[model samples]
Target: MEKRLTHFSSGSGCGCKIHPAKLEEILKDVRSDVQSFPNLLVGNEASDDASVLKINDEWALVQTVDFFTPIVDDPYVFGQIAAANALSDVYAMGGKPLMANALLCWPVEELPAEQASKVLEGAKSVCDKASIPLAGGHSINIKEIAFGLSVTGTVHPQKILKNTGAVVGDVLFLTKPLGTGILSTALKRGKLNENGYEALLRVATELNTIGAELVAINGVHAVTDVTGFGLYGHLIEMCKASEVSAEVYFDKVPKIAEAVQYIQEFILPDNTFRNWNSYAQFIDCPLPETFAWLNDPQTNGGLLFAVAEHAVDTLLNTFQKHGTTQFLLEPIGRILPKDEKIIYVKR
Candidate 1:
């Protein structure tokens, strides 16, 4: 009998990531020593997506690795999501992907070994689309199934973009709608509608390759992918890192229609509450329950970019040229001077 991978995905996938606050506490003692490794442009200090090493006057190397358990039932689809998620960090750093190494942890006792190959095939599909190789990887026996990739890419040393650099007047934009975690939860519970499943698949598998092009757009200042941490969680990280605040428009933020209805019924993944508890203090919302999309953890989510007011048209045109299906190309918020509230979600 064929096994359904989603059945094993209880608290797995990106939703199973270490708690953001706890992760901070664990890494707080570790600091980036620029004096010893001056070429390390972005390291552990600011929690940037990837660590960049300046290789020469004209080029830099970007490295990032991400692996997660099954978020979908198909082994191949899970591989696709993992590959896209891993590559997004490189794109976020304004780099183009070159190659990838696979990571597989499987329950050798229960599932067939062929499922593992399907997972690699799925990842390779995305890698092929990105014009990269699935060079090699390491696998281990485990009780639960997980898969992902370690992506390497290159970018101009001066062109690297971090989660920081947002100015007071910068405009914020989200490439995709919110609520992958909620929809994944619905799928695991056999409650997801066909449209919701399609939405989840498209968003999760769509590569955020546009991030690599943002370096050419003068109006764009900062770039980061919204993943397991959710929209509010990642935006707060950007604000605190850039020493700025944000004014988010609650109504303007795009979302999945099915996810919107599910939230009304309070259907959500545990990661939603975990994300909320980590950064609840920074979020200011009167109708918090109505806006619970802020805390829904995403798996292989979209890119969250901050751009200047004058460059909005350039950024939109660039996005159009890329021809990727990301929702709501308009601004969802704007950067503000440091304020009492880190994020102000206005109705």
Candidate 2:
């Protein structure tokens, strides 16, 4: 019999994350002394993808950790998606992962040990593709099956990117289409077709290695990976961090076609609302249906890059030269001058 990994958890994948608003409230009064450390290039204050610490004039260390419950029924695919999601933080920071450690929470009493081994194997495969070693990790016997990685990567000090570096007039690009959250919801409901499931796995498991390449481009000012926060939530963070507003062309944003159908059917994850409520005040969307995607929490998701307007063509050409397909480099919007609203979505 095939073991369905998602059945063990109440919340699947990144959808299990704490609501952004609730997280803010939890961290509001907390203070970290690490900010005083001069070598810390990037810290929690910026709400950036990864924390970077300068090792010297030439290099800096990038650190990030991410984990989530299974979003897919297959243990292997869930492992791949979770690892990819964790590795994305380093890529978003313009760093190449060097090593990683596993973070696992398994329900030993419920799920078979073989299933857990397959999950680790899946994660190991992704780590191998990223050219990093899974040196060690910690695990706990828990009520649910959770897996992820704590990755350490490195980049040249000057090349480190942050979500806060976006400037007014910058162009925004998303590497992958939105709607994984929606698709996962459909999967849970057993409404997703085989093709839709394949699409979900393909996108979720894809590595965002291009982010390291993007750092070499002088025009690329800011970079971030859209995860549990959703597209708008992450973009709002960028706007606030960079002190700029944005104009998102809703029609231009890429999405899984099947997800739209699911949305139309009212198949959506709970995180969709949690994500929207967290930052609804900062966004202005003309259509109510747009909320289905604008605030949809993604699992592995995509890298959102903010590049200079004039460099769009050059960046596209570079991507082409580097074998990045056209679909992955679509421009969805542009950074605008600061306005009363942080984000203005044009339908």
Per residue, candidate 2 scores C-alpha lDDT tens digits across 226-270 of 988899989999999999999998888888887878888999999
| Reference-based TM-score, model 2 | 0.97
Candidate 1 lDDT over 1-347, as tens digits, reads: 77788766567578989999889889988888878998988898887899899999999999999998789898889999999999999999999999999999998788988988999999999999999999999999988777889999999999998999999999999988888998989888888899999989988899988888899999788888899888988999999999999988878787877787788777889988898888878978776653468888888788898999999999888988988445677788999999988998886
Candidate 1's error at 93, in angstroms?
0.6
lDDT of each: 0.88, 0.89
**lDDT at residue 31 of model 1 (Cα atoms):** 80
Score residue 285 of candidate 2 by CA lDDT.
Answer: 81
Off by over 4 Å in 1: 324-327
The TM-scores of all predictions, comma-separated, are 0.97, 0.97
Q: What are the RMSDs of all candidates, in order?
A: 1.3, 1.4
